[model samples]
Target: MKEANITDRQKKENAIEKIGEFHRFGSILGLERMNELMKRLGNPEKELKCIHVAGTNGKGSVCRFIYSALLANGYSVGIYTSPYLTVFNERIELDGEYISDSDLAAYTDEVLEKVSQMTEEGFASPTEFEVITAIAFLYFARKGCDYAVMEVGLGGRGDSTNIIEKPLACVITSISYDHTDRLGNTLAEIAREKAGIIKPGAPVIMNVDTDEAKREIA
Candidate 1:
């Protein structure tokens, strides 16, 4: 039993290290690579019923609220958030539990195989967040989640999480002036980018306090 635990821990650590290697690719904000990668992975994101949340602030909190609400109502919910507060597993949660180390390692290896194929086929490598987003989609789909609360990792339009075709609902919370370099400087420019997650026919819920944000999102 002790040896098995050690082996599992080692495997998880190795998987995390392999994922970290993609950080060298930096944060390229586009969906072409994500779209191609998902195509190769059998398009798991399409299988999920997602509630997409995007904003300059409060999106993570909103995700948690929705996740908790769904879980409390007896739903199998998965919440995918970025920049985990502590461990990598925290970024992918289901039913109030972080993804197990064994499962994380297994899914990471599975996605890494697809990523390797992409590079071998002469496609650009996925960024770290893109790889993580792929893992979340795969995990949620395979786990038979009833719904997924997906928090945008960055600006919604080009962010890796925007790859989802349509969500059950699109929520934008409190857009602010942040990530000015990547998401643009003005509130309206930022709101437009954040509004990228809004798909036609999907209901939108927002809490924009500024006229600029309201005008752009409306």
Candidate 2:
């Protein structure tokens, strides 16, 4: 038992270190690298039904509500959120349980192979958030989740999570003056970025208080 526990700890530590390497790339908000990476991985994000949530605030709460509701209704739900308060595994969950360390390491290894291929092929390396998003998609798809609630890491328009072609629903929560440098200085600008997640046919649910933001999204 002691030997097995040590092995598991080593795997988790190695996986976390490898993933942390991409942090040097910072938050590059674009889908080009993510699209290529997903294609190389067989496009796992397309296999699962997704609910894409975006906004400056309340994204985590909204995602939790949706995930819990889905689970209560006997659905196998995958929850993907950002900026985990504690462990890295907290960012990915299925049916309220965090992803296992073994699964995280296995999926991280798979994604690392594809990322290396991308680099060898002259494609840019994916950012840290992008890599994590890819791992979550693979986990949710392989686990055969009925629904996946995805929280946007940054602005919705070009966020790695935006690689999802079509989601079951697009949700824009309370938008505020946040990420002004990256998103925009005004509410309308931020709203436009968040609105990018709204696909042509996907139903949208929003909770913006500002008319300027609402008009842009509407």
- lDDT by residue for model 1 (48-151), tens: 99999998889989999999999989999999998888888999999999998899999999999999999999999999999999999999999999999999
Write model 2 residue lDDT over 1-218, tens digit each, in one string.
Answer: 88987887789889999999999999998899999999999999989999999988899999999999999999999999988998989999998899988899999999999999999989999999999999999999999999999999998999999988889999999889989999999999999999999998999999999999999998
- Backbone N/Cα/C clashes per model: 0, 0
Show where candidate 2 strays beyond 4 Å.
none
Question: Scored by CA lDDT, what does every candidate get?
Answer: 0.94, 0.94
Error of 1 at 179 (Å): 0.7
Clashing pairs in 2: none
Q: What lDDT score goes with residue 12 in model 1?
A: 84
Q: Which stretch of 10 consecutive residues in model 2 shows the poorest summed lDDT?
A: 1-10
Give the TM-score of each candidate: 0.98, 0.98
Model 2 TM-score on a 0 to 1 scale: 0.98
- Per-model RMSD to reference: 0.8, 0.8
